[model samples]
Target: MHGYTTDKDDYLKRLRRIEGQVRGIARMVDEDVYCIDVLTQIAAVTKALQAVSIGLVEDHLGHCVVDAARRDPDEGQAKVKEAADAIARLVRS
Candidate 1:
């Protein structure tokens, strides 16, 4: 099972909330709402996504990476590298 399996439902709920926020932003644009207000909502959505990403990363490291290390060092190293790459992408985003 994936590392975040236990928290999968929570993640889904958070993602759904973020999705709604995005739709709201689109609605604001369609309504020609104030630009700054729209931008503020966009920022909020971005932060919310980042928060989810961080939680997933923590779960991965705590569960997946640790389990791999217990099973095999090489597998653990691979997982670590994969996780590092993922984090790099997140940071770049």
Candidate 2:
């Protein structure tokens, strides 16, 4: 794969933070925290997750998909299209 290399440590750090956020949300629910506060945390988690997903997709396109296309035009095109569709879905979500 020719994609941009992601720092595994960095990704893991983000995931751990997200996990903590999730736990915090659970705690908030148990404590009966305000609805708005809970929702705000949820939004933060959502944005964090989206960032990770976008980073992964971008890396895939920069490395694996592009490399594949370079070696085989048809396969590369298919991969690119698939990536585009995934991006669209991500955006819609």
Candidate 3:
């Protein structure tokens, strides 16, 4: 979080764009847009989300994990595992 503090505004802007994309998807569904076109937008949204997830993961590793490692070995190990699990979940999604 600390590492991301400086880039928080940028992140928020990106997320807002993604939110708009989701709304666009909903509108497309309501309008009965072509199936393939809808799927293409979905893929775009997915990639956008993954990009955000990767950024957050990087922030966590750089800030939280580093802090935890500095504070204590056990905490550091826990933080690393948590980060790994986060990546796993993102990959699965």
Worst 10 residues of 1 by lDDT: 1-10
Give per-residue lDDT, candidate 2, residue 62: 79
**Model 3 misplaced regions, further than 4 Å:** none
User: What Cα-based lDDT does every candidate model obtain?
Assistant: 0.97, 0.90, 0.93
Ranking by TM-score: 1, 3, 2
What is the Cα root-mean-square deviation between model 1 and the actual structure? 0.6
What pairs collide in candidate 2? 2-63, 3-63
lDDT of 3: 0.93
Give one digit per residue, the lDDT tens place, for model 2 in 1-93.
235355567888999999999999999999999999999999999999999988889788878898889999999999989999999999999
Best by lDDT: 1
Residue 38 lDDT, candidate 2, scale 0-100: 99
Error of 1 at 37 (Å): 0.7
Candidate 1 per-residue lDDT over residues 56-88, each given as its tens digit: 999999999999999999999999999999999
Compute the lDDT of residue 29 as modeled in candidate 1: 100
